[model samples]
Target: MLKRRLANTDLEISPLGLGTVKLGRNKGIKYPTHFELPSDKEAAQLIGLAKELGINLIDTAPAYGDSETRLGTLLTGQRQDWVICSKVGEEFDNQTGQSSYKFTPEHIQFSVERSLKRLNTDYIDMLLVHSDGNDVEIIKRFGLLQVLNDLKAQGKIRATGMSTKTIEGGLLALQQSDCAMVTYNLTHADEEPVLDFAAQHNKGILLKKALASGHICTHAGEDPVQASFNYIFAHPGVTSAIIGTINPEHLRSNVAAAEKAILQQ
Candidate 1:
């Protein structure tokens, strides 16, 4: 697990990041299987294991039911050893099991402040706009990127970007911010243009759904996981591929696959 400098930022992160949605939320998820939330001890163990496996990037969001809170508790003393990447714009409600988005300057500011409190950190390493499928509209209409930029200046966050859904929005995000998180996997290469642009411009690119949310891992293939990692790490634009796997064995396997993939590259 080699670390790559996140373009336009001083932060250096591993090629594979751990997505923490499953650590806090279980409802309204699209995983192939259902499971209960792990206890604090179990979650702490997972975090420790990730660190042992050379994963420095941890992606979490306020929408991920208490993920920030748990990480705050779990990552008590070793916060500096990890690069915390969190998001704003999306909020989840446990009662309805639904997520809502707000991209106003006021909401964005409030969300980042709250995330800082919840994650028990003074400043977040990376803060991305959690787009609600209205990627272009949200970035254009809300002026949220400016707000995020302000936060960066204020030292609340180090870098800013969007988890974009469309190529148009992805390109726009990279133009305006430090990076863009796009969906780039074996099944979905719709965002390749975005990756190409990042490569050309030297802007950061963090890939979400790198394994198609675990669906591709189950597909019939010789080694879909390895194949996915090879495809992802092979791309020069990728800063890191965020994989949400709670199982320790799965995480280790993924790291192994990602390491091999990077070596092949």
Candidate 2:
């Protein structure tokens, strides 16, 4: 497996990362029904598998119901071996069964503290601000950039970034915040400019929805998982892509694709 250096950070992560969105709730655009909410035992197995397969990064968020908890349960004793990236500014309401977005500084702090508890780690490797398309207000109202920097100084988080849905949002975030940024590849090819900017600025770029919610490989005749992995690896600016798979076979195949892609590179 190939390791890429995160911009402005000491972290070096594998190109393919494990995403835990599906492990929590299934409200996204193209939710997979192949797996149920993973138990702590299952999450431990998956984390161990990911480590053996050379995957270094795991992405989860507070909005992902029980995902942080499960990750915490699996990774409690092995904190130094993996790069765990989680998000703030969004909370999952079990009663409503929906995600509620809030970006106030207090909320950000509260979310981080809660995430720390759930992940069972003292410090998060990377912390991203969950976005809802309104970048300016989100930044101003939350004072997120400053708060994240403060947390970094306090050693609660190593790095900070935003998880945005639009290229415009990404670009704006890059200009305003010194932290890294994440975006989905499927709906926002318009993000090429932002990606170029990040590369030039030496900022970390994490990719989500690289599989287009499994639509890309599903549309192609090739194995959807392999195709999705290969497509993201073909991009130069992508530092890492998050993939969620519960089936051991599928996970192994995805890892194979990642290994082959690295060999080809």
How does each model score on lDDT?
A: 0.93, 0.77
Model 1: per-residue Cα lDDT over 1-265, one tens digit each: 7799998789999999999999899999998889899999889899999999999999999999989999998999999999999999999998888999988899998999999999999999999999999999998899898899999999989999999999999999999999999999998999999999999999999999999999998988579999999888888999899999889999999999999998887
TM-score of predicted model 2?
0.91
126: Cα error in model 1, Å: 0.4
In candidate 1, the residue pairs with backbone N, CA or C atoms under 3 Å apart (3 or more residues apart, or in different chains) clash, namely: none
Poorest stretch of ten by lDDT in candidate 1: 213-222
Which residue pairs overlap in candidate 2's backbone?
none
TM-scores across all candidates? 0.99, 0.91
| Candidate 2 lDDT tens digits, 1-265 | 6788888788899888898876777654265444467676787788889889889899899888878887787776789999999988777886677777888888889999999999898999999898877766787766787788899889999887888766677877776554445555544476677788887887778887777756565564666666556656666667888877766677787789777765665
